[model samples]
Target: MKTLVVYYSLEGNTKEAAEKIASSIGSDIMELVPVKDIPKKGLMKFIHGGSGATMGKGTELQPYTKDASSYDAIVIGTPVWAGKPCTALNQFLSDLSSTEKVIGAFAFAGGSADKCLSFLREKYPSIKYTVSLADRNSKKLAPENGSKLSAFIEELKSELISN
Candidate 1:
């Protein structure tokens, strides 16, 4: 199956996990870039980025050539903001709606992924698999949280083969 790993990263944590998943699954990758970059430091960053996600605001992304629907399966990754996915990732998911494609998601957060999972499940109920990671434990890609990502990739591969 042709799979794509799409993600948005404010810091490098989400990007690292995405890279590991892409490499493990041997899938193409796409990075979402917001037209206006979010601030990395200070309370304003939290107020703007966190509230944007909380309010379900979408950001303008740079021109991306790959279409998510073209892939047979898709894996989405993002850093959690205010217990939700980042604004840029939310925009990506908002623009992407495909019933024919198999979907999976992974969220990295400084705290927890409960709210992130809740949001994802509510928005994309068809997602077959999902995982959450803490940034402190996800410093390197190969084996984060007892190789959960690798395991997830293997499961996805199995599902693809079975289908």
Candidate 2:
């Protein structure tokens, strides 16, 4: 199956995880970039991002070449903000053109991602798999989270085979 990993990252944690997953599964990857991004540093980052996430706002994204409908499966990744997905990721999900393909997601958070993951599942009912990773604000992969990611990749592989 042709799988694509789509994600948006503000602090690189989600990017690192997305890269690892794409490399492990040998799938294509696409990064979602917002046209107008929130401040990356300072108190305003929290204020703006948290408010947007709390309101479930979706931002405008830069033009992307990948057509999600062409893939058999899609694995989305995002950083959890205010217990919800980041604005860029929300935009990507909202713009997704296909619903028949298998879907999966991964979330990065400072603490537990239970709420974010649940929110994703509820909003996107087609998602068949999910994994959460601790956002340590570093490029280095955590050992425990690595294992969880591996398990997620395996499940995705199995799902692809079944389909």
Candidate 3:
């Protein structure tokens, strides 16, 4: 199956994870870039990012080259902000035109990602698989989280075979 990994990253954690997943599964990857991004560093980042996430806002996105609907499976990655996906990812999901493809999701968070993962599942019922990485900014691709990522990839491979 042709799979696509789509993600948004502010601090590069989500991007790193997406790259790893794409490499492991031999899938194409795409980044979601917002036209007007929040402050990347400083107190304003927390204030703006947290409030935007809590309010479930979707920002305007830059035009992307990939045709997401062409992929058979889609894996979305995002950083957890205020226990929700980032605004860029929210915008991508909102703008997506197809829902019939198989969907999977991954999230990077400072701590627990339960709420973030739950929110994705609740909002997008088509998402069939998910994984969360804790403290991603500090220990991205560390040995501890390797097994979880491997398992996620394996599950996706199995899902593709079944489909």
Error (Å) of candidate 2 at residue 143 is 4.5
* Best-to-worst lDDT order: 2, 3, 1
* Candidate lDDT values, in order: 0.81, 0.86, 0.86
Q: Which ten residues in a row have the lowest lDDT in candidate 2?
A: 135-144
**What is the alpha-carbon lDDT for the whole of candidate 1?**
0.81
- Candidate 3 lDDT, 6-65, residue by residue in tens: 999998878988999999888999999888898988999899889999999998889986
Q: Positional deviation of 54 in candidate 1, in angstroms?
A: 0.3
Scored against the true structure, residue 6 in model 2 reaches a CA lDDT of 93
Q: What's the C-alpha lDDT at position 103 in model 3?
A: 80
Q: Can you tell me which runs of candidate 2 are displaced by over 4 Å?
A: 100-102, 137-143
Residue pairs with clashing backbones, model 1:
none
Instruction: Identify the leading candidate in terms of lDDT.
Output: 2
Instruction: Point out the higher-scoring one by lDDT: 1 or 3.
Output: 3
Give the per-residue lDDT of model 2 (tens digit) for 56-110: 9999898986988889889999898999999988888778777546389999988
Tens digits of lDDT, candidate 1, 1-163: 8999998988788898889888887899999999997888888889889999888788999987698888988888888888878889878877877744637888888777768977887777777888877786545642455477768778888877886
TM-scores, all candidates, are 0.89, 0.92, 0.92
